[model samples]
Target: MKLSPSVSIEQSETGLEFINVASAKCDAKIFLQGGQITEFIPKNNKPLIWVSKNETFQEGVSIRGGIPICWPWFGNHQNPNWPAHGFARTSLWQADEVHENDEQITISLKLPMKQVNTTYWPHQSALKVEFILTDTLQVRLTTTNLSNAAFSYTQALHTYFPTSDIKNTTVDGLQGAQYIEFGEGPFTQSEHVSFERETDMVYTQAAVQQHIHTPDGIINVSRENSSSCVLWNPWIEKSKRLSNFADDEYLGMVCLEAANVLEDKVTLEPKQSHTLITTISWA
Candidate 1:
């Protein structure tokens, strides 16, 4: 995958390169000193998550959704052009702008109507994604509905956080909120609580932020305008199937995603917009 230097390269003040692979479409690798990936990797199969290492993260992370502008439908419901998660994550997006400060690097990408065919989404829309990597990581995705009618869609940051143990971890955020547990069967909202194994849940109307208590330190997730939160750790058996993820790697990570799904879909009128913001800080 040869990305033209003109198309997909940005740098920090210290000269650390952020490789943006537009063809991989949803892939990004952040390289720091000694070429470490201090983030996440996109598995070829899922384009989400990565193998977790015990040390500090080596890769930056993958952005799973665009401002993933899904229209008319979401999830898997027999749509040809628009797949289960939406096309924004898989479609080619142009690098629009880049900036660097003393402490962080920010890169912006744009997906427009001219950039993509609006067959599944028959409207002109502008999707902008900004990746701000400072001491903490802040990812913001904003979608503007440029079309005439109102549009509704679901979105997620789908973050893969590095940790030490799945069993010894607890996410502190949705303590009193409601969540849809996917552990046994269909979606059902229950009281938000701690985890043990294979905990796949969607907390409804959750707080804008959450905290993961790992042995090393706490990773706080702060967000805005996103009412749903997802907590998942895919145990062992399921981990082997992923190419980019190592088996038993589940022991070193937990996923706490910021989402707008099902009951909390966003609707925008012509030229109106909505923003999904997520900030990951270590303490």
Candidate 2:
């Protein structure tokens, strides 16, 4: 492990790397390999994120929890054999900037196109992720097109939140939105969402803010420039098949992702850019 005043490089027993942070209103741990945040705990509040105690933390492997960045594309690729969630989650990122102020601390990391595999994304683009560590953690991910032509893709800030119990927790503020899961009906959300079994719903034209009513309390998840969000919990059997995840871990974790999918996918012209932002706080 290597240490700085507010940040450090920590390696798991398996030799996976992580950038541990404590510069601002919260403590965080981000993996340098993926620039993926695996942990964040704001002062005076309970831990909002959760990871498996049995996580393997192997290098070049995606971490099991916190906020995973799904870029360029999400889910299964058109080629079928391609990676499930694009390359950003497995690529190494450079820490381009780090700043601290009385109000907050900010860390910026950029993934240069040269470091990415052309087979996954043949376009010239620059991807950057900025994290504002404060009492309420804020994150912004930006993508800039460097080529003359246009490129389009869907993405998500696939964030996982901790809960006392999945069945007892409900996600409100999605009422009236439209959701689809497993080729099911384009169901209209007429009430708050609660879990009974496995869920993998993707909601489009969603509201900017939502509330997670966990046994601990209500957590506010707010988004900007986002029209879609995903609600997922791979309850029971599926949990046993996940990597670096415990079989019963689904009981304590739920993903409320800020996303751009289907109609909300982004298309950027030459030199154009798009940013998706989200903020979280406990009430």
Candidate 3:
């Protein structure tokens, strides 16, 4: 892979390789492991993505923050012993393309199926993630089915965002969407979402965009090819049980993931493809 002047391959102390970008528009870091992006900061603005300070950059271990690519499946699988999220977050990816110009930088990565354990994912498919960075950040996850048979799956770009205070942060633009929290009813959202306790809400038929009101400013989050999303914050007790996460870190971050889960799971026939896109910027 030929890297431009603004981008280079970097390795962590734990031997994980990632691509680092520093350009006129923004600075970013994307790990080859899991095809995950751990940082993105625009030229004149605060960071739009957040990662845990306690995160360990070990091979096969998913970093606790940033945008963890949940693919093949999201959350729990049918078998209790399977990994919580799919293997994509822990699998290594190949750098397929990298381009930089004055306006922005684009990096493309492909997940090699040979690295995937067939025991978990038997179907033949192609998965890739492309990051387009400028004063704003855009992530595109595309999957193409290669097998003759049709297959279905659920996924999410589990993006974590920063906040000066979770108490004052609120998410707007989900009005009238249906959500299921803690396996409860698919209740209708009557107002903007506020965090007071542990929140694990799966929403369907959501609007294409939402605004996150943080102490720093309002962040605009928009999605395409997705009608579902997730809002989560592990407050208090649950925060204590999380690994590679500080107990009090919940107060400073929140996750509003653009996803395809539950009723919005994707099914593709042979030769078909699908893409899930999410873009973030200060409003």
Candidate 4:
């Protein structure tokens, strides 16, 4: 495969496959296992995505940060033993296409449906993820139902963003949206969102865009075909329970996910398709 200066196939110490990119404007690292992006840095700005310092690049295991693809299901599954965020993040993906210009590189990967576990899925489906790494980062996840019956699922681009100080950071553009935290009631967001303690909230009727104000600068996050979003910071306890995360690591990162979950779950009829898109940029 002839790739640009910004793109190449690399492997982790444990033999995990990844696409490494370094362009004139930015740099990134993407894993082929889940079509997951583990790093994105635009020019002189700080890292827009964050990975756990304690993370071990192992096979069939989801990495702790960057943007993890949560597909088919968003959270804890009905069957508790099943994977929390579906199997996509742990499954291998086939790189199907690659396109590059002078300033940007785009790579596409497709899920191997024949090898997928049919136990959870309904209706024949097709899954694809694409990453466009330029000065900014853009991701697109597409799903198509090829069967005669309709099917539904929840999904998200579980994006982890870095912060100089988590407590001082605030997220904007979510005023008036309703959210639920820890299975609580539908509360409304009256102001820009900020974190203090352990925080996990899912917002409904969300706007198409939001902004994260960190000490360094503002990062813009925009989404398409998604009316729901999730915000999470372990703050303390849950961080200890996570496999690759440190107990105090929550203070350095925040998860502002672009999601289609709960009331926003997507249902597709025969031959129908849906695409969820998210873009991130920092100046």
Predicted structure with the largest lDDT when compared to the true one: 3
Query: Model 3: runs farther than 4 Å from truth?
Result: none
Q: Per model, how many backbone clashes are there?
A: 10, 0, 0, 0
- The deviation in Å at residue 95 for candidate 3 is 0.8
lDDT of 4 by residue, 1-283 (tens): 4666668899999999898887887888889888899988888867889999999989888989989999999999999989999999888998787788886788888999987888877559999999988889999999999899998999999999999899899999999999999999799999999987888999999999999999878999999999999999998878889999988899899999999999899999999999999999995
Residue-wise lDDT of candidate 1 within 104-184, one digit each (tens)?
556666665574555667777787777665455577878898888988877776677766667777777776666666534
Superposition-based RMSD of candidate 1 using all C-alpha atoms, in angstroms: 8.5
After superposing candidate 2 on the true structure, give the runs of residues whose Cα lies further than 4 Å from its correct spot.
1-4
Residue 43's lDDT within candidate 2 is 79
lDDT for position 166 in model 2: 90
**Tens-place lDDT digits, model 2, residues 10-90:** 786777767778764788888777788888898767887777777777777877888889988888888988887888888
Candidate 4's C-alpha runs over 4 A off are: none
The residue-level lDDT of candidate 1 at 150 comes to 88
Q: Could you tell which candidate, 2 or 4, scores higher by lDDT? A: 4
- TM-scores of all predicted structures: 0.72, 0.96, 0.99, 0.97
Error of 1 at 138 (Å): 0.8
Number of the candidate with higher TM-score, 2 or 4 = 4
Taken over the whole model, the C-alpha lDDT of each candidate is: 0.60, 0.87, 0.95, 0.90
Better of 1 and 2 by TM-score: 2
Checking candidate 3 for backbone clashes, the offending pairs are none
